[model samples]
Target: MFVSVGVRFEANVEALNMVETAGNYSKHRRVPYIIEEKNVLKIIYVPAVSGESLAHAFQELLAEEAISEKQKVCRKCLRGEFLKSMDEENAAEKFDGGKLPSDAEKLEEGIVKNCTVEDIGGFLYAGKPPVKRTSAFQVSYALPIKKIAIYSTVEPQLHARHAVMTEAGKKTGGEREGAAEQMIYYVETGTAIYGFTFNLDLRAIGLSAITGKPIIPEDELRARRRAAVKSLARMLSSTQFGAKLSRFLPLGGIVSLAVSVTEKPFTLTSPIYEGFEDMTLKRLEKIAKEFNEQYQYYVLGRNGLETPEHVMTQLIQYLKERNTL
Candidate 1:
């Protein structure tokens, strides 16, 4: 069975900008938008998120959660706790007179042969001139649910120490700088929504180079998809999202699925709103209904009017009903 899944989530944040561009204020200062001419008479600048950012976020989440069940797997690299490998590489380089072995040499000498984790799979196979895997997932750029507030603030930064230098036989130092101020622009309040779609085709993604397998089993794909979707929901509260400036707390999210017996894939480009959470079900149903008229698909969403768990439950139920649990 093939499935086309679309997901969207709401995030409540003090400041969150999915897309940032350099501003005229300073090279370091960045804002979420840029001015563009709508026509010969008018120009507009609006807050918008790029699809690239959402794609990257989802990719990171998926990579983090999707564990390759291969013989050679590095657990440390999978968790992003790869300090030991880095230290080992550095030590090896130091031992090799500050020059690491080339790719040919490393392959011939079998150095770090066991580092074939999913995270570094590309690098491991780089020697063969890698082939890219077209991602089955696609996400749209996020936009404000309604209105967005863009403002700037000036904050003071203090230097802890002054630069000191010893030239010749005398000690010299630059004048001590007390503090500096920086102008920062932020999105005060707005819930951004993005449209995302996943096209799951085992033939396109299931090939195993290690075993020379042509397809991945359906059970394994279901498990991976479940983990990935759960991780996607949890990614909003991730501490590494935007650090201090943006605190994107998880509000809620909805994911609807369209399972087909055939291989035809459909894309979901519908818009989602934050405050109008009830409409999520209605919208998904409408889309599913429209798509079902042309092709066979099973549609499911939350049958309630609540927040937080509504979307999560909808996803879980959808998966369960489809026997993908």
Candidate 2:
């Protein structure tokens, strides 16, 4: 089974993913988006979040969920450092000082067996005859919805830090020895309706990418798949997978969401475009008829639509009925 999700959300005064800082001014990540206006093409820079950021958050949540279910997770991944088997030394850490298999296939099997996060998230070992496992899941950068992207804005908000004056500073004419009594900074906050896509290949979990075989037992495979789905549902419902949430949590929930499940791989129309929900429904119908494959879809913006949790719950039920979960 393959699952694809497209999301459109509103974020207000959010600094969820900042890229750089220059002289007390931090900047939000931005990317160029092209659009056509009056028979002319134009490019606009808009605030965005990197796919790396989204992937990291997903893996972190996966680790947490896996551990809670008594599934194996590597030490580094458990601590949220996803330096997945970068080299021999790093791969060995998952084995607790045991010798790592020299054969690439054996190494991949061992790592998949030992770490649910690595199995789902993939890894590349830059060792002799390097081995690579592609991630079963894919995420796209969070970009502003194209229709209203021109109105999206990133503005600097001023903040200040004040320190108590010391007696020595008072004696030195209100000047601290090596520090200022007060400091001012600016945080670039963004407001927009952002869209992103996430896809998970359920067939890839607990399967050996190197040898085209199963690496773990069926029970564990089901557990890992469930963990992956639950992690995504939780992340979207809570909107808790970005930076600076303590102070700059976005003041919005999901504006719309669409999810598709297929027997074969299929991607939904991107939610950044207008009328994506209808487009996705039509495309799914065409693919089902053309390919003669079973598929299911749910959209949250439609009439009488349920919450994200409910939508995911329905998906889990569907997968369970098909014995895919």
Candidate 3:
């Protein structure tokens, strides 16, 4: 089973994913978006969130869900530092003194069995042969929809910090002398309708990428798969997967969502383009008939469609009926 989700959301005054702090100003991540106007091509810089940020949030939720279900999660991943088994020595740390097999296949198996997050999220072990496992899931950088890309804005928000000064410091005239009483800073906040895509390959969960085989038991695989799916559903529904949330939580929920579930790997039309929902439905229909495969699609924010949670539930049910879960 394969699942693809495309989301379009509105975010106002959000400093969710920042690049760096230069002096007292924090910059929001920005990317160049290209568009055509009057038979001419133009490029504009827009505030965006990197795929790394979204992946990190998803893994954190996956770790929490796996732990909640009593599934194995490496110590590092449990603490949200996903440095998964960098080498033989590092792999041993995850096992608490237990040495990992030297063979690449065995090493991959051991890591997959030990950490659900690593199994699903993948890792690269720079050992003798440098084993690598591709992540079962993929995420696209959250960007403003193309039609609204020109209107997207990143503006600086001013903030300050005040310090209590001693009587001597006050007498010397605060910062000019020796003591600074107040500090002003700016954080770049963004406002736009952002779109991103997420794809999950259910067949890859609990499977050894090195040997192309199932590395864990059937029941355990099912459990890990459940955790992986649930993590995504929870992340989207709560809209809690970004940085600087305490101070600059985006003032928006999901404005639109489109999901496609299929027997074979398939990705929906990216939501960054307008009319992506209609395009996705039409493509799904064409592919299903041409390939003679089964698929299901769900949408929200059009014609009073289903909610994200409901769509996920339907996907879970689809997997169960096929015995993929």
Candidate 4:
């Protein structure tokens, strides 16, 4: 049962950076590319966002949630436990290789025989191995419908240190506080629609082979999918990424989850909204009708538009019915 989601978000000074340092001109934030489509020599800057940013934001939120709630993460391997076991294994090896047949040798033998010790000094220590699990959640680059403008401004800040000219001044280098300036860039207000999808196919990932665990139980997979959906709903609401970017909150957006009733794997994405007004039940209905005859949708926001309350209610009901919640 795979599901596709379409997202439309309103930006009030929302900025997705191309590089880390937005203040530096060399590393100023950019969508992706600036190009021209023409027979004549011309150039155009295309404003776009990266899917990596979206994935990172969600992943950071998940890590924080796991830490705060004391919940175990299912998507990644337990690095802490693995590290501790490796440390013990290393200590045992050191002791076993010593001159005397000591108690550490017996301990080493026990550890070597332990079921948890899968591949010692093999793929674990050598090169970077590929990801084990396929991420069911995905996000596309957010490209604005209309042309966007970028504004650059320099702000002053106080610095705690300063440079001296002479060697004598350098020797007496004390706190010479001074004010510094830096330039910041921001994208002009515009709406960008980001496409999303969630593939529920488990067998394709080969989870059992990667994690050395049995096939993920139905209940667990359902729980993971539910969490992923909840995280998507909270993408704008949660400000773990930054309060400034998603500051104004999502004015309105449409998220549809089309679950296949049959055993076959299927996915369906809603049409990308060119503008906020485009997010409507009619658009969602078209996607649902085209993708799967049997499916459910959750429409959010009542910003001067006709929005049914039962959409959310029905979403919850369907989740409960599917034993996902």
Candidate with the greatest TM-score versus the true structure: 2
How does model 2 fare in lDDT?
Answer: 0.89
TM-score for every candidate vs. truth? 0.49, 0.96, 0.94, 0.51
Better of 1 and 3 by TM-score: 3
**Model 4 whole-model lDDT (C-alpha atoms):** 0.38
What does candidate 2's lDDT look like per residue over 1-325, in tens digits? Answer: 9999999899999998999999899999999998778889999999999899999999999999898777999899999999988887778866657778778888888889889999999999898668899999999999999899999999999999888887777788776542575898999999999999999999999999977889888988999998999899878877878899999988988888989999888889999999998999999999888989888998884545678777777778888898887
Q: What is the C-alpha lDDT of each candidate?
A: 0.39, 0.89, 0.88, 0.38
Worst 10 residues of 1 by lDDT: 173-182
Clash pairs, model 1 backbone: none
Ranking by TM-score: 2, 3, 4, 1
Which candidate should be chosen as best, given lDDT against the real structure?
2
lDDT of 4 at 184: 40
- Sorted on lDDT, highest at the top, how do the candidates line up? 2, 3, 1, 4
Candidate 3 stretches with Cα past 4 Å from truth are 94-96, 166-179, 302-306
Lowest lDDT block of 10, candidate 4: 115-124
lDDT value, candidate 3, whole model: 0.88
After the best TM-score superposition of candidate 3, give how far the Cα of residue 78 lies from its true spot, in angstroms. 0.7
Model 4, 179-219: lDDT tens digits are 22222433333334333333333232213334344334555
What ranges in model 2 sit over 4 Å off?
176-179
Error of 2 at 6 (Å): 0.4
Candidate 3 to truth, TM: 0.94
**Which residue segments of model 4 deviate by more than 4 Å?**
18-28, 31-43, 64-71, 74-132, 146-214, 239-293, 301-314
